[model samples]
Target: MEHAGKHALVTGGGSGIGKGIALALAHAGAEVTITGRRADTLATAAALHPRLNALEMDVTDEASVREGIAAAAALRGPVRICVANAGIAEGGPFAQTTLADWRHMMATNLDGAFLTFQAALATLGDDDAARMIVVSSIAGVRGLKNAIPYTVTKHGVIGLIRGLSEEYMRRPITFNALCPGYVDTAIVRGQLPGLMRRFDVDEQGAIDIIAKGNRHRRLLQVDETTGAAMWLCSDAARSVNGQTIEISGGQV
Candidate 1:
């Protein structure tokens, strides 16, 4: 019960890494509000824990984010832990990427985090201790091949945290990011078919190719990322701000 009585809001908590972290926060005694664009998906995740609640929110839209977070705060309390985890992962060669594709990536990955953090922060009082986290990809720290738009959005969120951390240093809030490499999420699984077709390899071969991107040469589990999130929300990590915790099993 490390997070007893606090309200933690996790965007994209309907599935994958977001769901995992929401459940963990609920287990730690926080009133967890999981938000996403899908009402059914959010309901399914909310049903997993007694402390978990569902909120349908579209992060890409400024109005949706502001209203949804306000509703969440009214239901529970001011958000003490804000996890901006809602994002899409679509990758293609830089030359083939259309302008719409780049715009969509920026809207969802970079702008979504910006809207979420801003809305959540607005709910907190001057003295309330809060933690704002962005779920970035390893591509944020380094370039990713054939994923120009995705890499740029991920890097943009890192810049968001770095800037917010400095600006809010005098306050009781902290801003940080998580950079994980090749986690076994639905997004990663969806890319396998493309990899198989492009490389003319079997499904397993494509999986192996993806896993090779990680330093450990294996796919990371949801719990690995959840554990890091739990630690960052704890009292021990109060001073650990403006940093990106890389969960790639080793150096990127």
Candidate 2:
């Protein structure tokens, strides 16, 4: 219960890595607010634990983010642990990637994180020590073929965290990014169909095909990444700021 009485906000908490972190925080005694675009999904997640509160929030919409976060703070308290974990992954040839495709990734991956952290920071008090974490990808640190736009957005989030951590150096807040390899989440599951068609394989075969993207030749679990996120929010990590935690089962 290291986080007892602290208020935490996690964007995209309805499923995948986001849900894993939200559940971990709630179990650790934080009053966690789990937000997403789908109310039903959020509601189902909240029912898993009494400490979790469901909030309908669209991170890409300015008014929605500001007002949603304000309401969350009012209910749970100031967000002492903000995890901007909502993001979308898309890939295509750089030559064929349309402006709309690029902007869509930017809106959800980069802009969404910007809004979530900014709104959550507004709720903090001067004396409150807080942790603001951005969930990025290994692609952030290196380029990934056929996913130029996604790679750019992930890199952008890391930059955002670095700059924020420096700006708040004198404050009680720390900013950091978690860059995990291809995580086994809904996002990965959704890729199975596309991969199956491309490789003429079944579900498991498709998974194996994509797992090669990781240096370890396997997909990392959602909880594996959540462990790093939970640790970052703990008091011990107060000094670990403006850093990137890479969890790819090997050196990136």
Candidate 3:
């Protein structure tokens, strides 16, 4: 029970990488609050773990995030660990990307993490140890062709973590980011059809196109990312702040 007595909050915990992290935290004895826009999905995910609780939160809205996180902290004690894993993955050429598209990506991927971290920091005690992990993507490190909006949003998230890490350098809180490449998640599955349509390719070709993003040419399992999150949240990682741990099978 490495996380015993710790109250952990995971945004976008309804499915995929967030769900994996939530389950791992619960198993480690933390009182976990799983947040998502979909109440039904949150409830279903919470049901899977006895220590996990569900909260309805729209990370894109400041008011909702402030209220929802406050309520969760009241119920589960101060939040010592927070995972900002909620994001949308949409891709298009920079010229073809609309203003609305850029705003949507920023609101969910970048703004969401900002709101979540702010609310979570309010609950942390001065002497208590804490971890804030932002789920960024490999796109944050390098630009992805035809994914200008996503790349920009991810880069923003990494910047948020780095700035926060420096601001809290003297404090016990550690801020870091995880940059994973093409994880086998529902989000990737949703992109397959779009990939096929855009490239005029079959299903295998569509899959291959994404798999090639990783050096090993295979989709990473959700557990791989979860393991990295768990390590960062552990007491042993006290000195590992302001770093981006990439899970792209090799150096990016």
lDDT of 3: 0.95
lDDT of 2 by residue, 4-39 (tens): 999999999989999999999999999999989999
Give model 1's TM-score versus the native structure: 0.98
* Candidate 2 least-lDDT 10 residues: 207-216
| Ten contiguous residues minimizing lDDT sum, candidate 1 | 88-97
Q: Which scores better on lDDT, 1 or 2?
A: 1
Task: Give each model a TM-score.
Answer: 0.98, 0.98, 0.97
- Alpha-carbon lDDT, every model: 0.95, 0.93, 0.95
Give the clashing residue pairs of candidate 1, or none. none
Q: What's the best-to-worst order under lDDT?
A: 3, 1, 2
lDDT of 3 by residue, 111-228 (tens): 9999999999999888878999999999999999999989998999999999999999999999999999999999998889988999999988998999999999999999999999
Question: What RMSD does each model have against the real structure?
Answer: 0.9, 0.9, 1.1
C-alpha RMSD between model 2 and the true structure = 0.9
